[model samples]
Target: MTDTAHALAASHTLWELVGRRAELTPDRPVLLQGDRRLTFGELRGRAERVAAGLYGMGVRPGTVVAWQLPTRIETALLSFALARLGAVQSPVIPFYRHREVGFALRASRAEFFAVPGVWRGFDHTEMARALGAKGVFEAYDDLPDGDPSVLPAPPADGTAVRWVYWTSGTTSDPKGVLHTDRSLIAGGSCLAHALRLSADDVGSMAFPYAHIAGPDYTVMLLLYGFPAVLFEHFALPAALDEYRRHGVTVAGGSTAFYSMFLAEQRRRPGAKVIPTLRLLAGGGAPKPPELYHRVVREMGVQLTHGYGMTEVPMITMGSPDDTAENLATTEGRPPEGMRIRIVDGEVRLRGEAVCQGYLDPAQTAQAFDEEGFLRTGDLGRLTDSGHLVLTGRLKDVIIRKGENISAREIEDLLHRHPAVGDAAVIGLPDAERGERVCAVVEQPPGAPALTLPAVTEYLRGEGLSVHKLPEQLEVVDALPRNETLRKVLKYRLRERFSA
Candidate 1:
């Protein structure tokens, strides 16, 4: 990290970081969207005004405020405004519907709720009203604004739990992950340092800003004094123009994002997809080595994947200076304060970046080990070089005939096949075998149709163990993915294919 960033990282609160960055680079742009730009000075100044506005509405320090809005300049302003007041924030993903939103509002006991009103056809305000949400307000195009003089002092304490983020909740109801300002700062610092970002680099947020990565990426920009383009609704082809317009140097959300860019590049082979694009970096889902090599060779860019969760925003991240072998096979290394432990092959983490705990006391108790390390439930081992090699999740291990089969191992091999665009290996219920291995694949455009026999034959040619071979094959147009990072919804696949 640069000296400026290191110094800025010492700030006790997000509002403090914003103020310091604005003081240092007031003229520099911090956010860009559709010809609109917000400089550091404007960010701090406007956020304070918004804080004053929110204060007028009776939102005081420690007041619980939940917001479900799209990724817009106004959303950041509102969030920072809340931060300025030291109010506890609960950000609900805009993609979430009644059940999730209601659950979050009720769980957090929010005193205020910010919604986009009517966004992308759905009426968020109406839904909030239906759910009997408190302090419902529309903050889509116009946010609350008041004189900065009316605002109270910004937050000083960073260790207090001030943020509640929801897990994807693939299998069950989403868990409310609690985070503090310092934990979020540590997470973003790790990301900014690992990527070796500079002020000259322009980043892009193609995912929902409501996700935990919202703060993670925002802190990186605040530290580095760079700007990132915001995409309210990210889709290929349509969003490509904005990326080109902003000259995004770093673009990625997850492995799925890498694949999306690769697919776009294939549409116009030999031509740079985004001319200014230099690196694709993200971490939410597993990254296949074949995807890494293909990205480097085909897209002509460095692809750095990482290990992160809602609990720990950034556990490990691949460095651009690392070797190709390590970059391709490992999830890089944790920063100085992060400690990684492996017990019975499960990756455990203990670091400042790690969240304090979940909202449920019981869940929090079960999530940590006796040593205070957060039990990740992810199976992985650290290489001799300290790079993390994640094999699979504990629930992802397939038990067929009393033998364990790694779904990630099979999925990684499947990516090498020419016709396979992406694959998800899942265990389906089988009366005889206990659980049958199922390979769900989505073939790339113009690739030959895949069959059960063809896929199994290819895996056999690749030397997959017989027991690990997928007993069932399901070819789909696309795998189910979450809106935030496009992580494949394996639980959905298990639900879909089990029948």
Candidate 2:
């Protein structure tokens, strides 16, 4: 690990690490948004001022402040300022409406709620007011600022619960996952060490800053003293110009991001998508080995995928130095402190990086096992080399003819098909077979249409068992995705195709 990374790993809190990095590399760039830049020194100074401003607004230590804003320099500044004040922060995704946003605000009991006023043609400030949110204010173009001298002493303890991150809540109300500064710092440290990044490496954040990944990625920048391009709105072709302009060495948010880049590369064959991009890495959804091989083979860049959730920002991450087979096939090994225990094929994690638990006591109790490992609810096995190969989720298994089949197993094989752009395997209710396997796919533009028989033949050729073959196939213009990382919403697929 680099000296800075070592220092960061030893630091107790996020603000402490940021301050230390600023002291060491005060002039180094920390954040880049279009033509504007913020250095380490300026980040700390501005955050302190914002901290004073928030403090003046009665945001004392332990105050719950929820902000739903886009990914920008001001958002980062506000988040760090909240950290500086030791306030409990719950960040809602900018695209979320009353259902998710109101749940988060009420659950967190936020004393102050910051919105972007009107963003993407939605009136968030008005919605906040309608929800009866306390201390609602706009924090898009301008953030709160005041004299730093009026602020109280920065919190010294890093173990206190100061962050409440929400789950996607696809099937139910989102859970407020509790976290502390030390846990977030540890998560970031794991990412920094696993990726083998350097100060010269330029990164990019194309996802929502309100997600747990916000702190996870920020921790890496402070540790490595590197800057990452921030994209408030990310899309292909249009976002490609900024990636190339910034010379982003590392880019990607999830499996969807990899597919988007690959699609762009396919559009202009024989030309590099982003001339300077050397690595594409992220986690939040499953990555097919075929996708990894295609990225490395076609894009001429290494692709390292990982395993993480809102409960744990990072669990395992493939390293660039690892063997290609391992990098392509498995989620990389855990760091020194992360303990991965597979109990009955369920992946359980115990580490400082793991979240404390949920805000509700009952949910917290149900989340951890007797030994204190966070029950990941994910089914996976550890290889002899300590790599994690995730199978289907416990709830994602299909039971056809009283036989169990893995959806991920089928999806991975389907990705190998030339006509398949992306695939989501779901099980619909069936009377005779218990639950029937269904394949929903998005084909590449201008590619031959895919049918159920053709998909079955391809899967059979790929060595899939008869029972696991998808009984139904649905081809759509695109797969349904959430706003956060564009993860395939299988529940939405089930809702659409169940009938």
Candidate 3:
């Protein structure tokens, strides 16, 4: 580990890190949004005031406060304020409606709920009230403020659980993943050290601040003493001006983000999309190797993808100095303290960055193995060089004619096709075959229509096994994706094609 990584890992709490960074570079910008900039000094000072306000409102250390707000400067401020008070904060994604939000509030037993109030045309305040959320208050634009002198002493212990983040809830109710200050710091340290970023590089937060990546990215900025532009709503071409205006050098949310940038670049073949963007990096969803190549070759930027989830914000990340082949084919390597074990072809993790456990004791018990390694349901193997190559999720395996096939393997190949813009391979129920491999794809704009025979022939040319060839092909205008990180929801694909 580098000296910086070691020091960041040793941070006692988020507030302590913020204070140390503020002292080091009081005037350095930490967060930015069109015409508004928050320096490290102001971040600490304002958060202290907000902490005092919440303290006066009966908030105490370990108080569970739930907030459902969009990605904005105010949201970041409120979150840091909660950290200053050592309050256990549960951040629900702003897009989550009654069912998910209600579930999170009840499961966390939150004493207070913060909403953005009619953000993006949704009345989150009304929804919170309808759910009978306690201590409901609007936290958009205006936030709580009071005298910091009245606040209690900041938290000294970093190991106490202070965060509750939810899983994507693909098939069932979202599980509240527990986290501590130290764990979040460790996760951020790994990301900061792996990306090889410097204080000079201006970054951008294109994803939801409510996601676990919120803290993961913030820790990077605090450690590196840099600033990141916060995007309340990110869409290509429309967001290009902001990226250029802020001179964002590092930008990316996930694979979907990479595709968006690539599409914009293709729209204007020779023009540089964002002249200052030198690197594209993210880690929420899978990165098809072909997409990596497209971004590098077409967009003319170094693309570094990582592997992470709600359970762990950052597991492995491709460094700038890594080889092009490794960067494209693998999920880079884990940082100093992260331990990755491949048990029965499943990826298991054990380290400071790993979450404490799920809120439900039963779910927690089933999550870890005997050695305390968190059993990640995703399947992957470590390369000879220590990089991770994820094959597919255990549930993503398709059984056709009693033979197992990996959907990721097929999807990766499909992404290489000239006409294929994005692809999702699903296994739909079939009476004769039990389950059949189906390839759903989105073609590039102005490209010729794709046919099933062309897709199979291309897969065959790529050395795919006959049995693994997709039995069905469905082309769509776009794949169904979740709002956060724009991860393609495979469950929705199955639902659309099952019948």
Candidate 4:
């Protein structure tokens, strides 16, 4: 074997993998968490029913069936069901305050929205009533209420819209990321290969199934012929309990989730949790490097991170044969057939697995290069070893009088401070330099107070440019995050600075 390559395990189509593997291991447990269990055969049965139901309800190829539901078996099955019938599925967080929900619904022109009659003790119906009053009404329901005998047939041609993933708006308001069943199924297979999924591993899912990672994990596991443990909530205790009790072997979620998981584990020492958990993974944020080492020692799991956005998500990830740096630092090589490049520090991808374009044609035109690479907005480079490395981000860099400073670097340095619990660095308005760096922080318990002068003094010790250092550092209790819990909200930080 070459010194590189991580060695190819070869790639397969998303549905091809799932359908083939379902046939291979039909009786194996495909989905389970707590008391719930569905063998591959059983799960496929439910998926068939969901496909039939969606088909029966006028969901068709190119139709966007918006899902506003929970992370339960029904939701996951419904997703696959729509995929089975060539229906493009668009799911937004069900609890998004009325404005955000209305915006996404209208933006996607969503025809069918499967919302709970009640969710998290609030009335989604009430929210629906409000939006309905605005001359905008979508087909809304509480949840699925059908049985397995009502299975539907798969679509004939493969051109149907598979999924329309919404961008997290780290830099701008959310936009629709469009992918086909062909592309999404490809994504599933690509992620499975990156993670080295095996039938022996019981996958643990915590991210919302609506997002790329969660649904991708669910489908990848089923398609890979492996058991998948589903969690409806991101509760750390429940997650650990699932690990210890149910023998979950792999996990993927956001950095916030892993941070909270570690915190909860520390709260209960000597708990033999996730004993079989060989891999602990994160995406969405570049947390401190210490997080990897901590997970290795405390949780008995190998910590890995990846590079993806809601747009061209899951193209790069750490592989099974990766070294420590390869695992924790760079996002692994572009998945199977994926193509990527870094021009002017902006990362862009072009491949079949990549999304076709955003729902808006103008936005799509703005996001891609002339030759058609999906501009990923992240700042990264490919390593000599063929791995993809994200340094900072193009949109997140702060420029002051032609001196470009990385907000990630400042955030990383701030996190190194013992008293700092969490920090978010952003660029706000500036009269001369075009933009100025601002540091918003949440302090650790009993942590010493951090002021602007102290932050400047610390950066000065590092010999950073005075202007490059944050002009302002405000201590706060929380920072806003989208469904993925990313902290690159330059918009809010800008308003805060202006006010």
Candidate 5:
């Protein structure tokens, strides 16, 4: 890892961050999959060649390049390669059907797509052909037919767009969220500070690399001189093993991930994990206090809660020393290079961590104030200690005649019921009481049948305000989840109940 002036100039890019990583631990492993592993030096060389190969195909910087490959070393390296060439990486989940993939391709406006003819057992060739995309870089990871070259030259400075992230389209077509080198680098720097990460840490994410959390978190890990392990998915059983195998000290993910693993822990009692494990952090949806309790008390790790979006990946959260209560109650204060304002009880943020906004200027303008604070659609209040406590989504609260109720408070209370495994509170259009409170629930495995009366009784015993209590309760098999497994399309419940 040479200290070229070019590296310093482009220090915010993914490849540049890894260059710093190489200097810190040249002989240490940077990536691991099953039995295979790559040291920093080896990874640097291979990724360089991959970048050069894409360059040879005229894949220039700022190019929106998509991935039709699986979660292999190639997919990871190609993502790095594109960033090195000043190109944007757009990763599509293999689970996405043809129609969904088409939407992503169109929304991202990807000019180049790297696809493996086949991945695992899936035949990607037909899908690639169906894509009808030109400049397709096709290669099979199981075997290499030819050699790739060294890294391509960096893109010119002050490039307008560094990355393109599609908004999770819970309701409609996903809009692309553009990022700059400034935004990406700022994200890395803030994450490093927020988690108090170190070179001794090994960061492994089980989510998709195309995500804001995935790639941005990887950049932070690599910049802090830590190796990052990627799983095809969140393999909880293998995760602890990999943590120990990679000497991993930090773990992070969503609330659902923790809940799933907790269920597994319940299934298999007496399961212990990596001795060096220090931190377990994540936040996508509202996390229950009990979840954090298990992560700290049972899993034997520090639990953290982060608040971010596809635009600004890591914005605010409880740090390592933050109490479990604060982490569960609040989204934490705004991080460095960011600002937070509460107007009419709505959260508004501004600064480098904020997204430049959506691709549409009209939407962007609508998302921000004339003064430039990104008007976040979340409702929250600042505690006397300056911690931010999220009440619920601005649109999720129900106004019953004169009183306002937070759905999150009701949902959290419903979760306390031993019979209710999962819950969502929605405001249904009601001719009476203005908008009535409705609760949708999922029963836990091996739990007794849950009736509406039983749920109402539990809510009442929990001492919820009468107005906050859900007037109607509907039991469902499972809630819908988006790519990251966060329940994004909650409106479905209201639609069903109305029908």
Candidate 6:
């Protein structure tokens, strides 16, 4: 972190940081969408107006306000407005439907609900009404505006829990992850410092703003005084023009985003997909080492993957200065304040960036150890040089005949095959082996079909242990993925192929 950013990081709250950044670079652009651009000065001034507007609607400090809005500039404004008021805000992913939305609203006990009314052919306002949401209001393109003079003093305590983020909930109901302004600022500071980004670099947010990454990525921009283009609805080829128009220098949301860009580059081999794109960086799901090499070799950009989740939005991140071996095989290193402890192969963390806890006290008790480190449930080891090497999830480990096997190990090897585009390895119910290894794969376009024998042979050739070899193979046209960061839904695969 630079001396300026280090000074800015000392700000007590998000609103304080916003005020500081605006003072430093008031005229600099902070957000860009389509033809609209918001400067640091505008962000601060407009957010205060919006805060006063919410105050008029009975929203005060600590009020639980839930919003299910898209990735629009307005969404960021409203969120910052709430921050200025010190109101507890719960942001719902725009793609979530009735079940997920209702769960978040009820779990947070939201007093006011914000929606985009009707977005992309869905009636969110109507659904909010059906769910009996309190204080339902629309906050899409038009926001409530009032005199900044009427607003209360900005929040001073950054440690107060003011944000509630939701888990992806691929297999079950989403859990509301509690976070404070300082925690979010810490998370974003770590990321910005790790990536070594500067004000000259332009970033892009292709994921949903409701995702924890919204604050994670936003803080990076605020700290560096750079602008990121917001994609309300992001899709490849369709969203390519905006990236080009804004000259996006850093672009990526996760491993899936890297694949999307790589596929686009393959369509036109020699030409750069986005001429201004210089780096691909993100982390939410597992990143195969082979994917990193292919991205560097084919797309001609530095690919830096990280490790994070809703509980800790920025854990470890690969740096451009790191060695290729470390970049390809490890998930970078944690920042100075972040501590990584491995207990029984589980990666536990303790840091200011880590979320306070879940909404439920029981869940919070179960998530942490007596030492106060948050149990990540991920299996990983710290390298001699401090880089994190995640092997697999504790739940993802397949036990066969009383022997433990890492599905990630098999999946990583499978990705090396020319025919395999993506793969998800799961354990299936088998009376013989207790649990059988199942390889579910999606073949790249124009690749040959793969069978069980062929997959097993490939694994054998890669020197995989006999016990870890997949017993069955299932090929599909496309892998099921969550809409936000495009993480593969492995639980869905288990349910689909178990029978």
TM-score of each: 0.99, 0.99, 0.99, 0.88, 0.90, 0.99
Estimate candidate 6's alpha-carbon lDDT, on a 0 to 1 scale: 0.95
Error of 4 at 426 (Å): 1.7
Q: List the lowest-lDDT window of 10 residues for candidate 1.
A: 166-175
Candidate 2 clashing pairs?
Answer: none
- Give a tens-digit lDDT track for model 3, residues 364-416: 99999999999999999999999999999999999998999999999999999
The per-prediction tally of clashing pairs is: 0, 0, 0, 2, 3, 0
TM-score, candidate number 2: 0.99
Per-residue CA lDDT of candidate 4, range 1-499, in tens? 1111121112233344446556767889877867878777766676666666666666666677777666777776777677666676788765465766777777878777766567678777678667762322222332343553554445554445567777654444678888765666556556776776666777777777777776566656655667777776666565676766778777767677666766665676786355677887657777566566666678767777776667755777777778977776676776768888889888888876677888899988898899888887788788999998776878688887787888877876777676777788888778877877888988867878988999888878867766678887888887766554543455676777765
Tens digits of per-residue lDDT for model 6, 260-353: 9999999989989999999999999999999999999999999999999999999999999999999999999999899999999999999999
* Candidate 6 RMSD computed on C-alpha atoms after optimal superposition onto the true structure: 0.7
Total clashes for model 6: 0
Candidate that beats the other on lDDT, 1 or 4, i.e. the better one: 1
Error of 5 at 138 (Å): 3.4
Q: After superposition, how far is residue 194 of candidate 3 from its true place, in Å?
A: 1.0
Cα RMSD of predicted structure 4: 4.0
Worst 10 residues of 3 by lDDT: 1-10
Q: Where does model 2 exceed 4 Å of error?
A: none
Alpha-carbon deviation at 232 in model 5, angstroms: 0.8
